[model samples]
Target chain A: MSTIGYKDWNVDLADVGAIYPFQGWEVAMTIVGVIFWLGWHIFQVKRESAHLEKAKQLGDHDKVHQTLERY
Target chain B: MEGNLNALTTVFTEFYYWVTVVFMFLIHVGFCMYEVAASRSRNHMHTLMKNVMIIPLVTVTFFFFGWWIYWAFPMFPFFGGLDLEAGAANLPWAETMGTNSSDRITGVFWAAFLLFSWTAASIVSGAVIERIRSSALWVHAVLIGSVFWIIDAAWGWHYGGWMVKYLGYHDAYASGVIHAIAGGYALGVIMVLGPRIGKFAPDGTPRDIPPHNPWLLAIGIFLIYTGFWGFYAACNVPIIAPEVIGGQITGITWTATNIYLAPTTLSAITFNFLMSLSGGLMAAYLVSKGDAFWTFSGGLAGIITASAGNDLYHPIQAMLVGAVGVVIVYKLHFWVEKKFKLDDAVGAVAVHGYSGVVGLIIAGFLLWGAPSSPFEGYATITPWGQAVGAVIMFFVLGFLPGWGVSKLQSKLGVLRIPEEVELQGLDYAEHHAYEDAKAEIIEADKAHLAARAT
Candidate 1:
């Protein structure tokens, strides 16, 4: 038994198709991947919002002036 | 496995695509250098990181679904159901997608498409640099790189796309399909994202946001030029016998064919690509009055403008088309900047979007009455058809999705960074740590000085 569904190299290559492990789980794999992708956006959006909120409270007028001056 | 001829052809095609993928990598390197050099010192690291990360993010996602989209969505929804027959061989779990000795071409061909995905995403990346939230930009990256760009490729760039069969769409080198769509997508994002604070003056005059390093910009453009050559070769089937193509042409002749199995040559494309590049550079220098950024971009614009007809154009016609297109794009860029307060950090919309649209329309007139495909019963290339194709690429597929999604994100308050973050640099800056460190260091130094005095 092979993860790739072939245990021997003697078979004709033309007869072979789907070579990756677990050949029939594409729809499930794709579903998992899509969830990961969508979940990332949700996670990133939340983290970025929190980061920005903390940054806004850092309103030091003097330091801002100094930074602006350098620019 | 099969006949020797079949094996040889398959192996050759696989090698050809593999080589194209390697060469296309330079395009990303060029964009990274170009963006970092253009951005200010404070923003360089962020700019570099933004583009560098696009490689992995796009790669993983493209492997996941982008490849499947090409095969599966060719006739999806509008014309017929998904082409599951074509898509079956490309599923990630399929043997052809991995280390199957029988099928060598599929992996490399998938990579060629993936490289194009990177290019599509990279184009959008350049236009929103220095100011866009990295998280916001990455979202745009995945959307353009893996999803939207691949869909466009299936619709127009594919050999059996509905656009090709029904609309007589002909973008031999993806002048419209990739460049236009990406540029239009960039334009859509930037319109909502706005410009850097100082990009315009109080009087509504547009100020030049110059690249910090002109030399880097120049080298970056040169690298892009090199990669463009690889892109041209990637669009062709290196060699195919007429019999194998199963077309009407009665000949034993072996020929290189465009994506649609129509004949062209490496030599013909080489002449046109360089000539067009030269034309754009010269015209951009004249038009922008030796502006370094426009001059470099002009070379890219020229190639893109001539790309649609390069498969069949006279080399001189390619040059002329490239030259004329640059002049128009250079003008439109400034006009749009002033007319609308949209801050495209780089001239991406003009370079990719305008140049692509113009090229398609020009190709329509130049290659009028020409067959769009080697397959019989397809609509012939025409001006109206080309215009429709351009709009579909730039507006329908490219701009609308980007705008709609970005608008949705904006409504959710997740599109742009907070005003405070934008004002402060988007780097590591904790409020108390630096000040506390400074105080501690000064106090310690004072004690050391007192000890020394005693």
Candidate 2:
């Protein structure tokens, strides 16, 4: 029932292989990880686009110019 | 002093811990910067000083008693009597406590533990910024850094700790021993000390008191992350042979081990650390809708959540654990703040304390029935044990002592700054001489300019 597969450390160290949790779920974890990575890119693009659109609507030209100058 | 190989191992271990101590100092640096950034400009110097002074105060007090408590109190009271035999060697008058050639490892090892003490105290320092009096906070620092946290460390972090033997409490990197306890301690104090005057609205709605300098706060958290890498390494014995451990393990192989002499690896923790950090950052960004402070803090909370099991967890488990922990912690922080009317100035209680309790319970399920120690006769890791351990850490050792002491301090009218002083700002009230001097100098310069013009 142990997630790391070993219930105890009584076995010899030489016989030990992987000791991480969920030994057979490497492929599933990889898929989950890929989804998170790809999803982040999608979300980030949408967020940036929304921010830029809002920025475009701002009427404070002088403030915008001042910010650019400061940058 | 011994065989050449033994001597080299001893010296190398000493130097290894010394390096980690240096690296861990950044945690305090980060704490000071973070506290100052969180406090308003009027309270900036007071906030910085309050954190900075914990280093020296905790250091001196730790040297006097904290190190001894770690050695002597591992199984004290509940399990057995004080380990006077072990305690004698760590006492302030002991040869090992000094620069004795026979004890090459003691000084550096003590320094490493002392740095942890600083961190425990500093965690509390952040939560009570702006409102707490310097003298009162210093007393709390010594209590947390030198007394209470060390007692818990003796009971759990020590190799012969009762929790390990009796309950299979396996906090490999001090999720409970350090973070949970410190967070709980902070919560206890803040509950008594109360929030900043304007932290809540007239109707008891919690207001978001943003950090005055977000950029500085970001840098501070970044430094804390860097120090955390060293903290992880410090929690491990860099190298040990099976024979040296004298446990169930039988082999010629040398390996890194967690504090309890269980085999783990730097490589393993490294993978989990980065993965968990990434998970926390991503989750926080999504959950907080890219709130910069929560995002930065989420990375921290994520590592803390995975830390208890990082020694054995897969990188993906670490990541998922971190992500889930962040979401829970984020929600809990607000719920507790709103429900209890408690103000945690820097989210210390949630990020460190609640995350620690969650990590411990998660480790219990994930590492269930696993060996808590390489030593025989130790209880196996279990959910019930971990849950109980979390309560003991966050409630008994962390909150109880903190609450009792703070209540006493509050009764004596010394726990918090005066209301007048609080409204005027701590720096202006306490360090008025410095302000007066600055004003006088400015006035003199203006007068000189007028005279020159005449």
Candidate 3:
């Protein structure tokens, strides 16, 4: 009934393999990880787009000139 | 000093821990950078020095009595008397504590624990910056670093600890023993120390005291992440035979074991660590609406949240636990700030303390009916046992002593710098000699330039 498939640490080490919990769900976990990775790109793209749009709206010619000169 | 196999294993284990100790030093460097970045320019020197001094102070005091406390206080005053047999070998004057060819392991092992001691004290250091007196904070450092946290380690993290034996207290990576207790200790000190002068509006709304240098802050946290990888490695027994464990484990096979000597794998913790870090980063970005600092800190919070069961968790389970803990800790940080008008300068209480308590209770349910140790006659992991263990860590050992000592310091007028000093800055106030010397040197340079011109 243990999630990791062993109820205790009594097994011989030579016989044990893949001691992580839910040992048989490698594909499912991979799928979840992939989804998470893709989702991050989507979130970052949307957030950055919105941010750049707002920055574009705040265009002040004198301030822009001052920023360039400072740099 | 023995057969080839035994000698090889001993030297290998010694080298492994020595590397982790070197890696863990980066954690302190990160703390210094993070704290200095969080503070204003006026408080920069003070903040850096405050954390930098923790190294020598904690290292010396830990040598004097802290190592002995870990071996001596595992069951003291509760289940049994002092463990003098265990304590004898760890005393400051013990031959093994010094350079000895017969014992290659003690130095590296003591250093590993000593680094953890610095972290516990440094966690407190961040929360009370700018306003606390150096003398006061140093006293708190020695207590938390050399006295309190080690006691909790003996009770929970040690292989034969009483909490592990009776309460099924399973903090595989010190979610409770180090993070929770240090967070609670920070909370206690700040309750009396109060906020930096301008941290609140007169109307009682909270004001954000953003870090002066976000780049340094980011770099600091990144270094901490790097050091944390070594911390995870240090928490395990690199290799051990079943016979060496002498528990219920059978056969001649060797394996890696957790601090409590229960079987685990380095591969398993590695999977959980990266997954949990990712989960935290994503959740923090979403919850904090892409605030850079919180996003970085979220990754750390995520790992702390999952660290309790990282050794045993499915990678996916670790990810979700970390994500959930980040959201809760983020919300709680602001809620406690506004409601109580208490300023935790760097959010230490929520990130470390609250996350630790949350992680411990969650582990109780997730790891229920599981064995807490390989040794026989120990209680199995259960919700009630973990809940009680969390209480002992957060409130009993951590908060009470911190608050009591701070209150005494406050009464003696030694806990905080004066109001005038607070406004002018601790650097200018306490280290006037350096400022005076700088002014004198500049004047002399100006006089030399005038004479040359003439």
Candidate 4:
């Protein structure tokens, strides 16, 4: 019982399509991946809002001036 | 595999794309250096980090889903549903995506496209510096790099893409697929994100916000030019048989083909690339009155403008076309900035966006009556087709989705940094902690010095 259908290299290469593992689970895996990609955008945007709220109150007049001077 | 000839062809093609990927990586390195140099000193590290992080973020997400989208999405909405048969094997968890002796080409081919992914994100990064939240920018990066641009590639750049087959789309070098979309998306985001403070006077007259280190920006663009040589090579199929391509060319000769299996050559592209670059730089220097940054970026914009037709254009035509496009793009960039009150920090909208649109239109007219595909009965290149192609690229695929998403974020008050924060600069969000630590350490140093003096 191989994780792949066959554990042997004796098979013809033309017959071999996908060779990794968990062969029949591609659809399920893709669903999970889509969730991750979309979820990331939601999470990131929220975290950015929170960070900006804090950043708005963080730096003083001197530091702000220093940043402008760099320009 | 098949016969000895087949084996050699597969291996050679694989190595060709692999080499191109290495060369294309320099484009990102150049972008990082350019952004760091263009940004102010206090904001320098954050700017560099914003561009640098795009590599891993786009790479991982591209591996995860972007590659699959290219295969699955080709005819997805307009022509038909997803091509599930081709896309199944490309799924992230599919064995072929990883190390497998059976599949030799998928890894390298995926990487070539991934490099394009990096370029798309990097183009957006340059436009929204010093003010955009890193987290917000990265979201745009991934969306543009891993998602939106690949969909454009599937629709327009792919061999079986509906745009190629139906609209007779002929973007041989991603003039619209990568560059145009990135530029449009950058424009859309900036429209919602607003200009950096002090970018304009109270009277709405735009001021020139010059690059902090023009020298580094120059070198950065030069490196991009070098990497562009590889990008041009990556767009071609190095060699293939008529049998494999299932095309009508009655020849035993194995030759280099463009993305569509139409005949072209490395020699032809090489001549066009250098001439186009020359045309762009020469025009930029003259147009900008020797302004260093625009002139350098002109070299890049020139290549992008001519890229759509470089596969077929005579070298001089490519040069002339690039030169003409740069002049128009340069003038339009400033005009649009003043008219719309939009601030694009690095001319991403003009260089990549407008040049790409103009390139597509120019190719249509120049290469008119030329077959868009090797396949029989496909539409030929025409002025109307290219104009339609440009609209789809710049507005539908590029701008609309960008505007819609950014609008959502803005409504949530998540699009732009707050007024106080924008005034303070995004760097302070990361720098204040450093300042606190520095203050603590300095107090200790002063005490030690006092003791020693006593």
Candidate 5:
């Protein structure tokens, strides 16, 4: 069976709409999309904070001053 | 012009393709900038010239015979003989090929395809930069642009193509037809062309060669993304009625169809495109740990990965497909680089070739049993069909011809520049001349100032 519900294009064009797969799962897909978005924020924030913490520990006074001067 | 409605439709269709052609020019501009930025200052002019020259070379060669091959070779040598009757109308000398009152669509349609040829050639140009001879690279450009890629298009991308009829090949936006073939061709060339000097260490560990100008490279990729929007549009027949298509589709409702005469919507592709790009970016950032180059290239890889089924995929599916493809491609790039010791300057093989192959196989499973064409008797989309189509695209048509040609060139001692030239850079002579000119002009200005003082 076609994943998109219709196996062929033998039907009338006026009768057709929304040929994407899993026709009745729009709500479920939206939920998944939301989860992905939320998950990304969580992951990114954690990584960024960890990275910043490491940077703060590693930065020396002279290098920071040199960087400021260069800028 | 015919009736008012017919005339309007014809003019609208012509303008649609014309606009897409104009937008697709940015892809070439982006390629030139990207190639130049990736190369060192000593090679900037040569790198830019190498990519910029692809336009006229592919353009002329495409005009000469490339367009005809698309119509004629859809089933050549295996399924049927050359469709010479259809081919005659597209020949360079044909009346419709030039300015013709009745043929409003020919020029714009030809141009849309010609731009794709340039892109295919430009992709190969990027991988072989800094070392390949201009003459050798141009020869490869013409072959890939006007010869090999078009042949794959005829087999897989054309409406009546055997791959669609028999294998159910469904690359709506040409993940395989354009990207895979070009990437595979680049791989073939680089294997023979060898790595740029200093690209490897004594122990054969690959060294990263940073871009000379990351900012230019970033802007270049962004321009490529913009041009890709036009590319998606160009792959479609903007509007057509069932009667004109003469397929199984009944009723008078006009709709846009992909190159294979399958129904889809511009709105559908739009939703999938953005979602896929986002998915690719997020995944790439995590996978490459926010490396600027891979992250930018990942966005492109994501689009290519989902493009095979973008016309039919749900937006969510597109995103996930793009994300999944990027991770796999990223891993494969490093693994292959280590194992094979082959240098691909821009990761063309991973972003385009591997993503394309993955997209096609994924489309097979996702779109399985879906009609590949609107016409009756066509095979349904299947995983095996897609897998086989990927082989034909990446290996038979793409890699073989590329390797064969490059090997022949290498045997003739003209495939790459001399070792001295490679060390000094391809633009060494030009840079010296430029410096000399600047010195001369400065001395002339000094002399003029002295005379004024006197």
Candidate 6:
């Protein structure tokens, strides 16, 4: 039993289409992909916000001045 | 040529592989730059030289016996005897191996595979930088580049390989065949070679050894990405007809095929490659908290992770696979470093080895039940098969040879450079000579100026 519906390559090349596994699940795969893309942005935003908040609290005046001057 | 169409196809195929070979040269260029950038100033020359020398050493040794092993050892000592009939045509003295009017594809095809051999060796070179003796590393380079990795390629990557027939192994882009085995080999050598001095504190906490030049390191990886385009192309047959393939495939439709002669398209792989790279980079950035080195390496790791199934995966599946693999590799790298105290100077083992193992297992599930080859009577792709293939690639072929040779070298007291040399840096002698030359030139210039004033 082949996941791709053909257990062997005995068929004519002209007859073969979509050799990739799970041929009918393109829509589901796309949905999962979209979720991952949107989820990444959400995760990144939250992490960045926390990082910035920590940075805002942890900055020392002298170190900040030195960093600014170096830049 | 028998016909104009046949002549054109042969010429096109020859040119295709030739172009890929030229493009793959950039991978070596990138490795040299990356190694030099990672090494401290005191060791830059030695580091560069160590990697630079792998090209010729591996090339010569590969020519001598490596290419023959691929054809001959596809089933030796396991499923059957050596394929002497097939191997004869690829022998070093074989007329086809050299310039012949009838055979145009041999040189370029050999070069394409030779570049992969160099890459396998280079991956190990990166992990053992700074502390390893150049002589010792060269021996490892020859072994991995010519002997061990090629054996894995014969078993898993070849069209008629036993692994593909029996285990349904499907590493379309060498996630395990090249990257995993090389990475595992690096792990074996490093476990015996030990970490650079001061890499760990008395309390056993690992310290960060930042790259000396981050810009060069960045450019180096980018070049590798560029060369990877060629690598992906090289893995393919470019173009072939079903009649020539002589497999179960029927009809006259000509198509591109993976190493296994399975149907795929360059367009499909292109989409998957870019998506997987993006996934790896994004995940690495988040996981490493935007650390530059890890982020860059993550892009590579991502590609390696998705590569096993990239030939058939949807672009989105490719991306997710890459991202997921990077996260696991990143976490595992640090975990192993802490737990085992194994110092991977450039994360070669995790980025290549662990990523490869993960990609193969993932491909097993994602591409499960897919035909491993276009040939009849082959096993279908399965998670169990891929897992076993990963073990054989990573542990059996990769780690064992590396560890055994390194152990012998260690006992002989030749595996690593002297402790003094490591502390002072591998390029100490060269640095002293450079400084002396500068001082002598400055003194002479001063003397000439004084005479002119007088």
- Among these predictions, the greatest TM-score belongs to 5
For residues A6-69, write the lDDT of model 2, one tens digit per residue: 7777777888889887888899988988887789789888988897898788678898899899
Would you list the rank order by lDDT, best first?
6, 5, 2, 3, 4, 1
Scored by DockQ, the top model is 5
Question: Model 2 scores what on Cα lDDT?
Answer: 0.92
Q: How would you encode candidate 4's per-residue C-alpha lDDT over B244-345 as one tens digit per residue?
A: 667655545566778887767788899889988988987787678668899999999999999998887766667778888999999999999999999999
What TM-score does chain B alone reach in each candidate, compared with the true chain B?
Answer: 0.93, 0.97, 0.97, 0.96, 0.99, 0.99
DockQ of each: 0.01, 0.64, 0.52, 0.01, 0.80, 0.71
Candidate 3 C-alpha error for residue A16, in Å: 1.6
Error of 4 at B8 (Å): 1.9
lDDT value, residue B357 of candidate 5:
93
Q: Which candidate model has the greater TM-score, 3 or 6?
A: 6
Predicted structure 4: lDDT: 0.85
Off by over 4 Å in 4: A1-71, B435-454
Which residue segments of model 3 deviate by more than 4 Å? Answer: A25-55, A59-70, B430-435, B449-454
Model 3 lDDT at residue B316: 88
* Predicted candidate 5 versus true structure: per-residue lDDT over B1-454, tens digit per residue: 8899899999999999999999999999998988898999889989998888899999999999999999899999799999999999999999989989988998899999999999999999999989999999999999999999999999999989999999999999989999999989999999999999999998999999999899999999999998998999999999998888999998789999999988999998899888899899988988898899999999999999999999999999999899999999999999999889999999988999999999999999999989999999999999999999999999898888889999999999999999999899889999899999999999999999999999
User: How well is each residue in B154-258 modelled by candidate 3, as lDDT tens digits?
Assistant: 999998899999998899988899999999999999999998998999998999889999999999999998898899999999999999899989889888989
* Docking quality class, candidate 5: medium
Backbone clashes in model 4: 1
Candidate 2 lDDT tens digits, B231-326: 999999999989999888877888899999999999999998899899899989988888999999999999999999999998988998999999
For candidate 1, give the docking quality class from DockQ: incorrect
Candidate 4 vs candidate 5, DockQ winner: 5
List residue ranges in candidate 6 displaced over 4 A.
Answer: A58-62, B452-454
Model 1, residue B91: C-alpha shift (Å): 1.4
Query: Could you tell me which 10 consecutive residues in candidate 5 chain B have the lowest summed lDDT?
Result: B281-290
Provide the lDDT at B163 for model 4: 89
